[model samples]
Target: MFSLIYGFYKHMVQKDEYCVLILGLDNAGKTTYLEAAKTKLTNNYNSIHPSKITTTVGLNIGKVDVAGIRLNFWDLGGQNELQSLWDKYYEESHAIIYIIDSSDRERMDESKEIFDKMIASENLRGIPLLVLANKQDIPECMGVREVKPIFNKNSHLIGKRDCMVMPVSALTGDGVDEGIRWLVDCIKRNSYLRPPRNQEEM
Candidate 1:
């Protein structure tokens, strides 16, 4: 009886772990968003000052527990050369968080181009996508309204999957909570199709 009771307790304590990808163009605030998320979701995590956070040449990884689920984020470098390495992690990922620097109007088209290409991949099909319009705190940043139409134009590519485009300021932590909550709910609902691993993300 003791052994059985212990097993039940273990089952209760072990969380379903999901791997998520954080992708976007360089300087689009992918790492900042990841840091902001860690700071907010995990207790006592000190976020790096934005000025001190340099461009990610390789990858940045972060793990946080939210709503009893463990989300392992593999934040790949967004530089053009590094993007080629993104596919290496996709098969293991349960979701994708594509960050966009809404403030960079000059590169909005380029960002959209990459987003479309990434979404068009067969490996990422049926996966939930959370598109975050980062750097919304900047007064000159493009509004979410402007950002939506760009992606929405390719709605056919986004077909039938759980997806959202949300405005966020990773620096200020605004919209992070709502975005994460939405993502968690989407992941749970889609687990039947792509079940989360019992072990931590590799």
Candidate 2:
């Protein structure tokens, strides 16, 4: 009886829309990471279909099917000229993945500004984030410890935020799978942590 009720609840009460918007400063390997994720999931199931990847001029779409859960990933082009366009998609996303260039020291300020702008936008506030310190294969690449404080400086989201900072090598596919799995778990459990909904008139 319990199993039947749980199955009914799962079918009726939860209609999930899983989406992730991958954002970062330009050349942060957003495209590479997407390809690596596709390859990783495909290899796990022995899928031979090649993923056709093109430069994400404005947006790139990648889909992953896992246990009846559909994950739709968007690769947003991260350039100053393209930044204004991101606001349009903020509300539609369930998660935000920020990629940073670990070896580039000169653009840290700009990257921070972009990160601030992301959550500050009217529609994106309260969204969870996963920060990836990419280019970890480089000898001069910055580690997660060195880059985390910059993301944590936002006091507005201190208690309400959820972020995972990790160093990854998109070239070597070192930490790509872990990152995706972390995102998957976050999406699945997002509503579990939210406070009780107010009983308001519909």
Candidate 3:
């Protein structure tokens, strides 16, 4: 009888956990975005300045509880050498945020190439995607309208999952709240299909 009650107590105290992946090319502001997100979602988090946040060669993790669900973010490195390691995390991710360096027009093609690979993967089927056009604070940076068409060309590979292209400036922390709220809601709606992990499973 005691064991039964203990199990029930544990279950009530546990929160559903979801894993989110942050992927993009090097200097696409992936780390900056991660930091901004942490500061936004978690109360009183002192975020590192965007200029001081360097490239991630491996991963930077942040856990934040939204409502009752816990989101675990794995911010991976974006260098050419690191791109190959992204797929290894797909099997565990519930959603993906693909950061785009909108200010750097030259690397758009290269970014698309990598993004296509992710969309083509069977492992990522049904996983939600959020494309954040970083550096929107720049005077000449591409906006959501321009960035949309570039990724739209690969729509064939996206399947019928929830995907959105939004504008954000990690440096200035604009649009971070809306973007994260959307992601949280999408994952909740999809939780029945891909159920979030429990404490032990995560």
Instruction: Give the number of the best model, judged by TM-score.
Output: 1
Clash numbers, per candidate: 0, 0, 0
Q: Write the per-residue lDDT of candidate 2 for residues 1-202, one digit (tens) a residue.
A: 9989887766654434477899999888888887777777764643323245445687888876554456678998987889888888887787788999989989988998888878787665566688999999999878889998887788675446567888898778899888878877776677454321222222
Ranking of models by lDDT: 1, 3, 2
Q: List the residue pairs that clash in candidate 1.
A: none
TM-score of each: 0.95, 0.79, 0.94
- List where candidate 2 sits over 4 angstroms from the true fold: 1-16, 43-55, 192-202
Q: Stretches of candidate 3 above 4 Å error?
A: 1-9
Deviation (Å) of 168 in candidate 2: 0.9
Best by lDDT: 1
lDDT per model, in order?
0.91, 0.76, 0.90
TM-score, cand. 2 vs. native: 0.79
As for lDDT, the candidate ahead, 1 or 3, is 1
* Local accuracy of candidate 1 as per-residue lDDT tens digits, 1-202: 9979977887888889999999999999999999989988999888788778888879899999999999999999999899888888888899999999999999999999999999998888899999999999999999899899898888889988999999999999999988988999999999998899996322
lDDT of 3 by residue, 1-45 (tens): 998997888888788999999999999998888898899889999
Candidates arranged by TM-score, highest first: 1, 3, 2
